[model samples]
Target chain A: MWRKLLTRNEFYVALVVVGLCLVIGAVNPVFFTVGNLFDLVRNSVVMGIFSLGVLIVIISGGIDISFAAVAAFAMFVTAKILVPFHFQGTILVPFALSALIGTLLGLINAVLISQFRLPTMIVTLGTMSAFRGFMLAFIGAMEITNLPPAMIAFSRSFLVTIKQGRFTYGLHVSILILIVLAVLVWFILNKTMLGRGIYALGGDRSAAERAGFNIRRIQLFIYCFVGFLAGIGGIVHSALVRTARPFDLVGTEMSVIAAVVLGGARITGGKGSVVGTMLGVVLVVIMNTSLILLGVSSFWQRAVLGLLIIIGTGIPAYQATRRRRAA
Target chain B: MKQIAWRAILPKDTNVRWLLVITVLVFVSMSLLRPTMFFTLDNFSSMAFQFPEFGLLAMAIMLTLLSGGIDLSIVGVANLSGILAALVLTRLLPAEASALQVVLYSLLALATSLVTGLTCGLINGLLIAVVGITPILATLGTMELFTGIAIVITKGAAVFGFPELITFMGNGSLWIFPVPFLIFVVAAAVFAIILNKTAFGAKLQLLGTNPVAARFSGLNNTKLLLQTYMLSGFLAALSGIVVLARTNSAKADYGSSYTLQAVLIAVLGGVNPAGGFGRVGGLVLAILTLQFLSSGFSMLRFSNFFKEFIWGAVLLVVMVINYLTNTRRERREALLQAKECEVNAQAD
Candidate 1:
C-alpha cells in the first residue's frame, strides 16, 4: 500500500505541498503559526470544493470551465433572495438553495452536452459567459454589498478550535463542512460503481458503454455535482468577504482548473483522484497565501499558477509521448 | 443542389448565407427599434473605428482554429505586443518630434509590435508543435505568461499618449471608411487569398482535417502547425498595435474580454471548432454582424451584459445545430458506404 501510494502522483504532490509549507515557515516563522495555517485551510475551502467538481468532470473525460459561473449564479440567486430578509437562522438555507440552483444549471449543461453530444469545453465556455452575463444583468447589475447578519456571522464563525501553548487556531465552519464533503466525495470516487464507471467512461467511451456503464447518468452526476460544489464555493466566497457580490470570483475557474490539473488530473480524462485534487487545492491556497507573506503582490498568483499549469500538463504530456516512442 | 451551387462560390459549410439573413434581420429590427440612432453613418463609422481591434483578433484566432487548434493566447499576445510598442513609443522617441523622427518612431513601433508578436507566437508554436502540448493548454499557458510579462513591465498601469501618426493609423479614414476598418479589410483580403491560393493553406487544410493522414502523406505537420500559430501571433500583434494606436494607451488587461469574443466571432463565422472549414470573407461578415449587434445594443441604451449572453447563446445554439446536421449527414454516408460494400461483395 505504501509502495502504491508512493507511485501515485498525489503522494508526491502532498509531499511537495508539505515541504513548501515547511520552507515557507522556515523563511518566515509567522507562516507556520497555527493561526496562519488555519487561515490557509479556510481560504482554500471554496477552491477546494470547486476543485472536487473539476476533478470529477476531468475523471469522466469532460471539462467544464463554467463552475465559477455556476457558483456565482447559484450564490447570487440565493444571496439576492436572502439578503433582503434579516432572518435569524442557519445559513443552510442559502447553501442548500444555492446547491440546488447550481445543480439545475449544471443539469442544463449536462443535457446540452449529453443530448447533443457537444464538446464539453466549448459548451461550458458558452455557459460561462451566459451565466455571468445573466448575473451581471440581475437587478440592474448591482453588486450585493450588504449581506444578512446571519450569513455574515455564519461566514466568520469557525467550526472547530484548537488551543496550544498560547496560540488559538480555528478552522472555519465552511472548511469543516468542506472536509466532510471531501470525505463523502472521496468515498463516492473510490468506493462506488459510479466511480469505476467514471474511470471507464474516460478511458474509452464505447468500451465503457459496452460494459454497461451509464454514460448519461455519470455525465449528469458530474456536471450537477460540480455545479453544486460551485454553489458551495460561492457561499464560502461571499461568507469570507461578508458580502454576496454578483461578479465575485470572475475568471477564477482557470485557477481552480490549474490546481486540479496540477494535482495529476489529466485533461485527456480517466485519471485523477480526490486526494490529489485536495492536495492541489491546498498547494494553490498555500502558494497564494505565502506569496502575500513573501511580500509579493497577489497579482503574481495568476502568472505563477499559469506556469504551474503548463509545467504540470507539459511534463506529464512529454513523459507520455516519450513512453509511447519507447514502446 | 443548392448546397453544391453555393459551394462553388463559398466554402461548402460557410454559414454566410444564413449569417447574411440574420445580419439583415438584426439591422432591420434595430432600425425599426431605434430609428434615430441605429442607421446613422456616424454610428457606423465609429463602430468601424473600433471594429478591427476584436475583428483582427478574431481573424488571428481563426487561423489557429483552422489549423485544428484554438489559440486562447491571442488577447495575451496582442496585449504583450502592444505593450512592447507602447514602450518603444514612450521611451525610445525623442521629446521633440521631427517629421523624420515621427516616421522613424512609427516604423520602429510597428517593428517592435511584429517582433514581439512573432517571439510570443514562436514560443506558442514550439509548445504546441514541438512539445506536443494541446493547443488550448499551450495557448492558455502562454496567455498567462505573456500577460504576466506585460503586467510586470507596466506594473498593471496603462501606458498612454502615442504619436499622432499612430492615432491616424487607428482612427483616420481614407475617403469615407475608417483606417482600422480599412486595415481589417486588407487583412481579410490577404487571409482570403492566402487560404485559397496557397500550397501552405492547402497543407493546413489537410493537417486540420486529419493529422495522421497528413503525416502518412509525408506532410510536415509540426512545421505547418508552428507556422499557423506564428501567423496567429503575428496577427494578434498587428491587432495590439492598432489597439494601442486607437486607444492611445496600452495595458496588460486591455481587451481582457477579447479571448472569448474572438472565439465567438470565429465560430460564428462558420469556422468549425473541429477545424478544416472557414473563410476570411465569411469571417469578415461575422465580425460585421457582431459589431452591428453590439453597437445596436449600445445605441438602444442596452447594457453590454446582453451582448455577452447573446454571444454565448449564439455559440451554443449554432454548435448544437451544426452537430445534429453533421451527424445525420455522416450516418447517411456511412449507410451508403455499407450498402456499396455489400453490393461489391455480392458481385465478386
Candidate 2:
C-alpha cells in the first residue's frame, strides 16, 4: 500500500506541500499561526476554484488560457450591473449573473473550437485578448469599486473568525462555495458518464468518436464548465479584494496553470484529479506567502515561481522515467 | 483552364488578396480622411520605425511555428537582451562620453544584446529539443525565467540614457530614412531568404509535416528544431534591442502586450498555427496592416482597447476561413482518390 501510494503523483505533490509548509514554518514561526493559515486558505480558495476549471479543461485534452479573462470579464460585468445596487441581493444574484455571462463568453470560444475545429490554445489566446479588450472597451474599464453591500458583508462574515487585537483570520463564505464547488466538480469528473466521456475524448479524440462519443458536445461542455467556474472565481476574487479590476487578473493565467500542471494534470490531457489540484493550489499559495514573508524582491518572486514550476514537473517526469527503467 | 492554372501557379494564400484589397482601401481612406497628416513623410517614417519591434517578434513566432512549436518567450527574451545590453553600457562604459566612446559603447551594447539573445535562444532550443518539453510549456517557463533575470539585473527599474550613437540607431534618421527601419528591413530580408531559400527551412517544414516520416527520411529532426528555436530567440533579442533603442529605456516588461500581438500578426499573415506553412512576405503585409490600423486609430483618437478586440476577432475569423478551405481541399482530394481507385478496380 505504501509503495502504491509512493508511486502516485498526488502523494508526492502533497508531500511537497507539507514539506514546504514545515520549512517555511521553521524559518518563520509566524507562518504557522492560525491567522496566517486562514489568509492562505482564503487566497487559495479563489485560485483553487479557478484551478478546478483549468484541471477539467486540461484533462479533457485541451488548454484554456482565457479563464482568467473570462472570470474577470464576467466579474466586472456582473459587478457593473450589481454594483449600482451596492450588492443588495443575497449573494446568489451576483454568482448566478456572473456564471451566466461567463458561460456565454465561454460558449463563443467553445463554438469556434468545436465548429471550425481550431486549436484550443491559439483560439483561447485570441479570445483572452478579445475578452479583456471587450471589458476594457465596452464594459466598465475602471474598477468596480462601489461593490454590492451583501457581497462585502458576506465576505466579512466567515464561517469562523478568531480575532486577536487586529489580527483576525478565519474561513469566509467564499471558502464554503469553493469547497462545495470542488466537491461537485470532483463528483462530476469521477462518478458521471460525462466525466468518463470527457476523459475518453481527450485521451484519443478520433477513437472516442469511433466508439460513440459526441466529441463536439463534450468539447463545448468542457469549455462552458470552465466559463462557469471563471464566473464564480471572478466574483470570489472581487469580493475578497472588494473591487473588480481587469488588471488584477489579466496576467494570472500563468499562476493558475502552474498550480494545475503541478497537480499532475498533463497538458496533453487524460490525467488529473481534484484532490491533487486542491493540494497544488495550497502549495502555490503557501509559496506566495512564504515569499512575501521572506520579503524577497517581488521581481524574484516570478523567477522563483517559474523555477519551482519547471522543477515541480521535471522531478515527476524523471521519477517516471527511472521507474520505467527499473522495471 | 487558364484560371485553374493561374491558381495552381500562385501561392495558397488567397486570403492575401482580400487582405491587400482591405489594406489599400484602409490606406486610401486614411489618406483621404487625413490628407495632409496620413500622407506625410513623418507619419510614414514613424510607422516604419514602430512596426519592426513587434514585426521581428512576429517573424520569431513564425520560425517556431514552422517547426511545429509556439514561443511565448519572445517578449521575455527581448526584455532580457535589452536589459543586458543596457547593463553592459551603463556599467562598463564611462558615463561622460566623447564621440569615440559613444561609438565604442554602441558597438559593445550591440554585441552584448546579440550574445544574450543567442544564449537565451540556445536555452529554449535545448529545452524543447533535448529536454523534450512541449514548445509552449518550455518557452513559458523560460519566459518567466528570462524576465525574472531581467528584473534581478535591473531591480525592476528602467535602464536607459545610452550614448549618442546607440540613440541614433533607435531614433535618428539617416538621409530622412530611419536607421531602425533600415535594420528591420535587413533583418526581414535575411529571415525571408533563410526561410524560403535554405535546406534547413525545408527540413523544418518536413518535421512539422510529420515528425516520424521526417525522422525516417534520415533528417536530424532534433537539430533542425533547435536551429529553428535559436533563430526565433535571436530575432526576439533583436526586437528587444530595437525596443530599447526606440524607448531610450529597457524595462523588464517593456513590451508586455507584444507577445500576444506577435502571435496575432503571424496568424494574420497566414502562418498555420499547426505549423508547416508561412511566408515572410505575407507576414510583412500583415504587420503593415496592423500597424496602419493601430497608428490610424491613434490618429483618429480611438481607444487602444478596440485595437486588441479587432485583432482577436480577426484571428477567429481568419481561422474559420482557413479551416473551411483546408476541409474543402481535403474532401476534394479524398473524392479524387476514391474515383481513381474505382477506375483501377475496373481496369483490374
Candidate 3:
C-alpha cells in the first residue's frame, strides 16, 4: 500500500507542494501565516476550477482551449445582461446565466467534434478565436467596472478573516465554491458509469464503442460539463476581481493547461485525478504568487515558468521513450 | 512537354485549383467593388510590403502542419529574432557610422536574426523530436520560454534604432516591386521546389502519413523531424528580419495574434492538420486570397475586430467544406472498390 502511494503521481505532487511550502516558509516566515494561506487559497480558486474542467476533457481524449473564451464571454455577457436591468439580486442568477451561456458555447464545440468529426484542437481553436472576436466586434469590448451589487458584495464576503498590521486577508467565499465543485467532480469521475465510459473512451475509442458506451453522448456531456465549469470559474473570477474585461481570461490558457498537464494528466489522454489536479493548481498558483517573494523579477518569472513546463513535460516523456527503447 | 512542365509547376490537387479560383474571385470582386482604392498600384505596393512578414510566418507554420506537428512558438521566435537583431544593430553599429559600416552591420544583424531563429528551432526540435514530447505541447512550452526570454532581455520594452540598410530592406522598392515581396517570392519559389523535388520533402510526407511505416522502412524519423523544425525556425527568422525592418522596432508582444492567424492560414491553404499532405502553391494562393480580403475589408472601412471575426468564420467554414469534400471522395472511392470486387466475384 505504501509503495503504491509512493508511485502515484498525486503523491509526488503533494510531496513537491509540501517541499515548496517549506522552502518558501524558511525564506519568509510570513508564508506560514494564516493570512498568506488565505491569500494562497483565494488565488487558487479560479485556477483550481479551470484545471478541474480541463482535466475532465483531457481524460476523455480531447482538449478544449475554448473554455477561456467561454468563460470570458459567459461572464461578460452575464454582466451586460444584469447591468441593464439593475438586478442586484443574489449571485445565483448571475452564475446560472453565465453557466447557461457557456453550455451553449460548449454545445457548439461538442456538435462540431462528435457529430461532424472535426479534430478537437482545431475545432476549439476556431471557436476560441470566433467567440472572442464575436464578443469584441458585435457585443462590447469595454471592461465593466460597475458590477452588480451582489457580485461586489460576494467579492468582499469571506469565510475566514485574518487581521495583521493594517492588512486584512480573508479566505474568500469563492474557495468554498471551488471545494464543492472539486468534490462534485471527484464523485462524478470516481463513482459513476459516465466516469468509466469517459476513461474507456480516452483509453481506446473503438474499444469504448465496442463495450457499449455511447461515445457521442459522452463527448457531449464532457464538453458541456467543461463549459459549465468554465462559466462558474469566469463568474468567480469577476466576482473576485470586481470587473469583467473581455480579454481577461484568454491568455491564461497556457498556465492552466500547464497546471493540468503537470498534475500527471497525460496530454495523449485517459489518465488524471481531481486530487492530483488540485495539487497541480496549488503548485502553479504558488509559483505565480510566490516568485515575487522569492525575489525573482516579474519578467524572469515567465522564463522560469516556461522552463518549468519544458522540464516537467520533458522528463516524463524522456523516461517513456527510454522505456520503449529498452523494450 | 509543356503540359508536363505546367503540371510540375502547378500542383495537381483540386484544393489548389479551388484556392486559385477563390484568390481570383476575391481579387476581381475587390477590384470591382472599390476600383479606386483596391486596384491602384500604390495600394498594391503597400500591401506587397505588408503581407510578406505574415506570409513568411504562415509558410513556416505550414511546414510544421505538413509534417504532422505545430510550432506555436514561431511568433515567439520571430519576435525574439527581431529583438536580438535590433539589439545588435543598436549596440554594435555606431550612430555616426559611414554607409560601409552600416551595410556591414546590417548584414551582421541579419545573421543574428537567422542564428537566433535557428537556435530557437533547435530547442523545439530537440524537445519534440528527441525528447518525444507532442509537437503542440512542446512548442507551447517554448513559446512561453522564448517570449519570456525576449521580455527579460528587453525588460518588456521594444528595441529600436536599426541601420538605413536594414530599414531599406523593409521599405525599399526595386524596379516597381517591394523588396519584401521580392524576398517572399524568392523564398516561396525555393520552398515550392523543395517540396516538389526533394527527397527530404517526400520523406517528411511519408513520416507524417505513417511514422511507424517510415521507421520500419529505414527512414530516420528523428532526423527528418529535426530538419523540418529547423527549417520552420529558419523561415520564422526570415519573417522576424522583415518585421524588424518594416516596423523599425522589436518587442516581445508584437504580432502575437499572428500565431493563430498563421495556423489559420496554413489550414486555409489546404494543409491537413492531421498531416501527410500540403502544397506550397495552394498555401501561397491562400495567403494572397486572405491578403486581398483583408485589404478589401480595410478599404471598405471595416474595423480590425470585424476582420478577426471574418477570419475565424472563414476558417470554420473552410474546415466544414473540406470535411464534406473528403467524405464524398472517400465514399466514391469505396463505391468504385465495391463495384470492382463484385465484378471479380462474378468472373470467378
Badly placed stretches (over 4 Å) of model 3 are B1-11
Worst 10 residues of 1 chain A by lDDT: A134-143
List ranges where model 1 is wrong by over 4 Å: A1-6, A162-169, A297-299, B1-14, B327-348
Steric overlap count per candidate: 0, 3, 0
What is the Å distance of residue B123 in model 1 from its true position? 0.9
- Which of the numbered candidates is closest to the native, going by highest DockQ? 3
**Tens digit per residue, CA lDDT, model 2, A1-327:** 999998788998999988988877787788988888887888788899899999998998899999999999998899888766555668889989999998999999899989888989889988998888777878767776778887788668788878889777677767888889999999989999889988887788888899898899998898998999999899889888988787778788888888998888987888899999998888888777678676676768768877877677766655564575579
- How far is A95's C-alpha from truth in model 2 (Å)? 0.6
Top-lDDT candidate index: 3
Give the Cα error of residue A77 in candidate 3, in Å: 0.9
Q: Could you give candidate 1's per-residue lDDT for residues B1-348 as a string of tens digits?
A: 887886687544426666766778888998888887878888889989978989989999899888889899999999989988988989989999899998999899999999988888888898888777778888888888888878878889999988899989887889999988888888888988889899999988888888889999999998898899889998999999889888889999988889888888888788877888788867887888888888988887778887888878877887877777778889999999999999999999
Give the CAPRI class of candidate 1: medium
* Cα RMSD, model 2: 2.3
Q: What's the ranking of the predictions by TM-score, best on top?
A: 3, 2, 1
* Deviation (Å) of B326 in candidate 1: 3.3
In lDDT terms, how accurate is model 3?
Answer: 0.89
Question: CA lDDT of B72 in candidate 2?
Answer: 89
True contacts kept of each: 0.49, 0.54, 0.59
